[model samples]
Each structure stands twice: as structure tokens, then as C-alpha cells.
Target: MILETRGIGKRFGSVLALRDVSMGVRAGEVTCVLGDNGAGKSTLIKILAGVHQHDAGTLLVDGREVRLTGPRDALDRGIATVYQDLAMIPLMSVWRNFFLGSEPRKGLAFDVARARRVAREELKAMGIDIRDVDQPVGTLSGGERQSVAIARAVHFGARVLILDEPTSALGVKQAGVVLRYIARARDRGLGVVFITHNPHHAYPVGDRFLLLNRGAGMGEYGKADITPQELTSLMSGGAELEELAHELRRE
Candidate 1:
């Protein structure tokens, strides 16, 4: 396994956001975290990304206990998270954004040309099509930006990629594009944690499913253990759906 959390819990003063949440991600597989709003999904990802200190839990990387103090700590351990915001500077060119804060240095100068070439090559290698690496990041479509972010994470040696709502704002076609990059990331042998509310999006690529409701885990299921319809029903409230169906029936 690439990453694991045992009995992870987070609290905000008196309220518990998560309780005893244990999940694992393995190389070459995608673990989809499906939850409704306020279901502790964000809290879990934040803990994994080191954005928040867990109130209680054991975090393991490669089966060894480790303390993730902050985002840098996570990155140092080869765990990278691409948030919903995409994190690309809008006015900056793609290549510039790609090398932001970690630019290639050639004799005390940023290697601008090298960065552009490398950014272009890396995207191409990942099967991402970009008209030019010098285009401002804002000019790229949402899916393209997400793909660029994913490519950046992989190029930087991310062993585990935690994505937060990657396809939430995307249209069907754009979502499809991002989904392809996700599969590509998994194919390259990186363990992936995909957090989303979209069942259709998760069902196709996920190898394992984790469902959360109101800051608690319902359960985790393998792909073979649950169908997409079943997963959706669970997410939408199985009993609630049945009640609504019964209420809507006309005699």
C-alpha cells in the first residue's frame, strides 16, 4: 500500500468531522471517496495532504508510521494533492506556472527555455494536447488545467495523488478529459485518492469505493462488491429514495 490511515478522526471544538476513518490506497489503483456535502470528505483529504493535524489517528506511508506536519511534509514524502482550485496562476504562462517556486536553475538563473520545453514534453508524454506551453494558464480550459496539474504532480514524483473534487465543475466532455488523465495517473502506478460527489464519474475508474455521510463512514466497498447503481443509491440515501418513490406513486 502507498498510504493508510488508521482510526483517523478530526474534531472542530465540540463537533466531530470524522471518526475512526480508516482507508488505504495502493499503487496502481484508485480509491474513490464518495460523500454528500459536509460528509467529512474534505477533512480526510486535508489530513492526508497535511493541511490539518488529525485530532486522532495513525498515518502510515509504505506501512511505516509517519507524522505529516503540513503540506510540505506530505510533498516531501512523495504525496501530492491537486485541489479543486487547480492552483495555477491565471496570468502566468503554462510553463511558468509548471515550474513556479521550483524552477530549474542554470548558473543562478531560472532556465525559462528549459522549463517551457520540459513542460511541453511532459504534457505530450502524458497524452495531453496543448497548443503552446507559453499560453497563459487562464486561457486553458478547465479540463486542460486539471490535466496540467495532474501532470505536474506525476512529474514531481508523487507516489500518491489526492484529488479534491476534480470534476465537480466540469461539463460531461471536460470531465471525460480529466477522467482520462486520472486513469493515466493510475496506469503509471501511482495510488490515487479521488474525492467527489459524482457517482457516475467515480464508478467508471474507481477500484474501491468509500462512502461517507454527515461526517461518518458508511462503508468501503471493492468494485466487485458493489454496483454503480448500489453505490449511487447509498450515496443518495437508500431509504430516503425508497420513501420518495413510494410517496410519488399514483394509485
Candidate 2:
């Protein structure tokens, strides 16, 4: 396993947001973290990404226990997180966004040529078909933007990529496009922690699934051990969903 959490728990003053949650992401595999709103999905990923510290249990990277100081600490250890907001300037060119903040320097000047070339090459390598790296990022489709972010993280040598709700705002076609790039990243040997509430989106590419409900572990299973239908049935209020469906059915 490249990243693993054992009995991880977190608290926010009077609220215990997460408890006894354990999950792991292996190299070249996708670990899908599924949950509804307020399921502690955010809290768990925040802990993993070093946005928040865990109050209990252990976080392990490469088989060693760690207490991450912050997001910078996680990044230095090859753990890169791409939050839902993506941290990109919409008006900036794709290449500029790719090398933002970490731009290469050539004698006190930004290496514009090197940045553009590397961005194009890396996107091509990831099988992303962006028309031009010089185009503004805001003009690209949502899926295209997500792909570029994934490619950037991979290019920067991320051993483990934690993506938070990457597909939530996308339509079916666009969501599928993002899922393809996610699989491409997994193929390149990055342990991907894909956080989402949709079982339909996750079942296709996930090697392992961790279901969260009300800040606790619903269950964790390898793909072979669980079916997509079963997964959807395990979410918070899953059983209640069936009852609601019955009431709405036409006779």
C-alpha cells in the first residue's frame, strides 16, 4: 500500500466528525471513498491531505506512521491533493496553470518555452486531447480541466493523489471523460484516493471501495467482494431510499 489509514478519527470541538475509519490506497489502483454529504468524507480526506490533523489512530505512508504538519508536508512526501476547487486561475493559459507557483526559472526569468513544451508533452502522455496548451483554462470543458490537473499532479511526481469530489459537478459525458483520465493516472502507478458519493461513477474504475455513513465506516471491500448495486445500498439512508421509492411508485 502506498497510503493507508488505520482506525482514523477526527473531532471538531463538540462534534466527532469521524471515527474508526480505515482505508488504504495501493500503487496502480484506485480506492474509491463513497459517502453522502456530511458523511465525514471531507474530514477524512482533509486529515489524509494534511489540511487537518487526526485526533486519534494512525496515518501510514509507505508502511511508516506519520503525523503530517500541513499540506506542504504532505506534498514533500509525494502525497498531492487536488481539492474540488482545483486552485487554478480560470483566465490563465493551460500551460501557465500547469506550472503555476512552481514555475521553472531560467536566469531569473520564467522558462515560458520549457513550461509550454512540458505541459503539452505531459498532457499528450496522459492521452488528454486538449487542442492547445496556450488556450485559457476557463474555455476548456470541465472534464478537460480535471484532466489537466491530474496530469500536473502526476508530472510533479505524486506517489499518491487524493482527489476530492472530482466528478460531482459534471454531467454524464464529462464525468466519464474525467474517469478515463483517472484510470490513466492509476495505470501510471499512482495510488488514487477518489472521493465521491456516486457508486455508479466509482464501481467502474475502483479496485477497492470504502463506504462512509455519518462519519463512520459503513464498510470497506475489495471490488470482488462487493457489487455496484450492493454499494449503492450501503450509503447513508440507503434502506430508507427503497421505502421512499415504494411510496412514489404508480399502481
Candidate 3:
């Protein structure tokens, strides 16, 4: 396993945000974290990204227990998180945004040519087809922007990629575009942590599924252990959904 959480729990003030959640992601596989709003998905991502520490249980990286001090700590450990906000400057060029902080230095000056070349090469390696490296990021479609972020993480040596709702705002075609890049990353031997509420999105590329409901775990299942219907039903609260349908039925 590349990353594993054993019975992990997180608490904020008196309210416990997560409890007894055990899940792991292996190299060259995608582990989908599926939940609706307020399902503690963000809490779990925060812990994994080193934005917050787990209050209980253990977090293991490559079988060794450790505590991350902050986001930098996680990155140094080869755990990279690309939040939904994307954190990309819209006005910046694609290549500029790709090498935002860690720009290559040539005698105390930024290497613009090298940055553009490397960014284009990295994006191509991941099979992401961005039209131009010099185009403004905001001009690209949402899925293309996400592709840049994913490619950036992979190029920078991310052993584990934690994506926060990459496809939530995209249309059907765009979502498929992003999903294709995700599979590409997995194929390249990177363990991907794909967090999304859509079972439709999760079912296709996921090797394993982690279901969270109201700050607790529903369960985790390998793809072979559960069908797509079961995954959608379980994450959407099968019994509750039925009850809701009946409650809203015409008289």
C-alpha cells in the first residue's frame, strides 16, 4: 500500500468529524472516496494532505506510522493534493501556473523557455492535450485546467494524488476527459485518491471504494466485491432514499 489509514478519526472542538475510517490506496490504482455533502470527505482529505492531524488511530505511509506537520510535510513525503479550487491563477499562462512556486532558476533568473518546454512535455506524457502552453489558464475548459494540475503533481514526483472533486462542475464530456487523465495517472504507477460524491464518476476508474456517511464509514469495498449499482445505492443511502421517494409521492 502507498498510503493507509487504520481506524483513523478526527475531531474538531466537541464534535467528532471522522471515526474509525480505515482505507488505503495502492500504487497504480485509484481509490475512490465517495460521499454526499458533509460526509466527512473534506476532513479525511485534510488529514491526508497534512492540513490537519488525525486525533486518533494511525496514519501509515508505506507501512510506517507518522504525523505530518503541515501541507509541506505531506508534499515532501510524496503526497500531493489538488483541491477543487485548483489554486491556479487565471491570468497566468498554463506553463507559468504549472511551475508556479518551483520555477527553474538560471543564474538567479527564471528560466521561461525551459519552464514552458517542461510543462508541455509533462502534460503530453500524461496524454493531456492542451492546445498551447502559453494560453491563459482561464481560457481553457475546466477539465483541461484539472489536467494541468494533475500533470503538475505527477511531474513533481507525487506518489499519491489526492484530488478533491475534479469533475463536480464539469459537463458529461468534460468529466469523461478528466477521468481519462486519472486513468492515465494510475497506469503510470501513481496511487490516486479520487474524492467525489458521484458514484457514476467513481465506478468507472476506481479499483476500490470508500464510503463515508455523516462522519463515519459506511464501508470500503474492492471493485470485484461490489457492483456499480451497489456502490451508488450504498453511497446514496439506499433505505433512506426509498423512504424519501415514498414521502414525496403524489397522493
Candidate 4:
């Protein structure tokens, strides 16, 4: 396993954000985290990404118990998170954004030629067909931006990629584009933690599913053990969807 949490719990003063949440992420596989708002999905990934520390239970990376101090600490440990916002500068060129913080340098000067070549090569390698690397990031489509972020993470040596609600804001076609890139990443042997509220988006690409509700776990199931319909029902808290179905039925 690339990453695992056992009985993990978190608290925010009087509120408990997560309790007894356990899941594992493996290399070359996608672990879909399904949840509604306030379901502790964000909290759980925050802990995994080192933005927050768990107050209870254990977090293991490569089979060793370790406390993550902050985001950089997590990155240093080969765990990288690509949040929905993506953290890319809108005005920057693709190559510049690709190596924003860790830019390659030649004797105290940025290696412009090398950076450009690498950025272009990496995107092409991932089957992303961007017209120009010189284009400003803000001009790219939402799906294109996401593809760039995923490629950046992979290029920077991320072993486990935690993506927070990656497909939430995209249209159907754009979402499909991002999903293909995710499959490409998994194919390249990166463990992908895909967090989203959409079961339709999760069901197609997920190898395993972990459902979260009200800051607690519903259960974890492999794709073979759970159907898409079952996953949607559980994610919506079962009764709520049934209630909606009854209310919407024709007279």
C-alpha cells in the first residue's frame, strides 16, 4: 500500500470532523472517496496531505507510522495533493507554472530551455495535446488546467496523488477529459486518491470506493463487491434518496 489510515479521527474544538475512518491507497490504482458536504472528506484528505494531523488512530506511509507536520512535509514524503483550485498562477506560462516552486536552475539562474522542453515533453507523454506551452494558464479550459496539474505532480515525483473534488465543476465532456488523464496517471504507477461527491464520476475509474457520511465511514468496498447503484445509494445516505424518489414519483 502507498498510504493507509486506520481508525483515524479528528476534532475541531467541539466538533468531531472524522472518526474511525480507515482506507488504503495502492500504486497504479484509484481509490474513490465519496461523500456529501460536511462528510469529513476534506478533513480526511487534509490529514493525509499533512494540512491537519489526526487526533486519533494511525496513518501509515509505506508501512511506517509518521506524523506529517505540514504540506511540505507530506510532499517530501512523496505524497502530493492537487486540490480543486490547483494553485496555479493564471498569468504564468505552462512551463513556468510546471516548475513554479522547484524550478531547475543553472548556477543561480532559472533553466528556461530545460524547463520548457520538459513541460512540453511531459504533457505530450501523458497524451495531452496542448497547442502551445507559451499560452497563459488562465486561457486553458478547466479540463486542460487539471491535466496540466496532474502532469506537474507526476513530473515532480509524486507517488501518491490526492485530488480533491477534481471533477465537481466541469461539464460532462471536460470531466471525461480529466478522467482519462487520471487513468494515464494510474497507468504510470501513481496511487490516486480521487475525492468527489459524484458517484457517476467515481464509478467508472475507481478500483476501490470509500464512502464517508457525517464525518464517519460507511464502509470500504472493492469495485467487484459494490455496484454503481449501491454506491450512489450509500453516498446519498440511502433514506434521503429514497425520500426524494418517493416525493418525485408521478401521481
lDDT of 1 at 119: 96
Predicted structure 3, TM vs. truth:
0.96
**Whole-model lDDT per candidate:** 0.93, 0.93, 0.96, 0.95
- Compared with the true structure, model 2 gives a TM-score of 0.95
Model 2 segments beyond 4 Å from truth? 240-251
Q: Which candidate's lDDT is highest?
A: 3
List clash counts for every candidate, in order.
0, 0, 0, 0
For model 3, residues 1-251, the per-residue Cα lDDT tens digits are 98999999999999999999999999999999999999999999999999999999999999999999999999999999999989999999999999999999899999999999999999999998888999999999999999999999999999999999999999999999999999999999999999999999999999999999998988899999999999888976897988888989953
Worst 10 residues of 4 by lDDT: 235-244
Off by over 4 Å in 4: 239-251
Please give the range of 10 consecutive residues that has the lowest summed lDDT in model 2: 232-241
Residues 100-171 of candidate 4 have per-residue lDDT tens digits of 999999999999999999999999999999999999989999999999999999999999999999999999
lDDT of 1 at 221: 93
Clashing pairs in 2: none
All candidates: CA RMSD in angstroms?
A: 2.1, 2.8, 2.2, 2.6
**lDDT of residue 43 for candidate 3:** 98
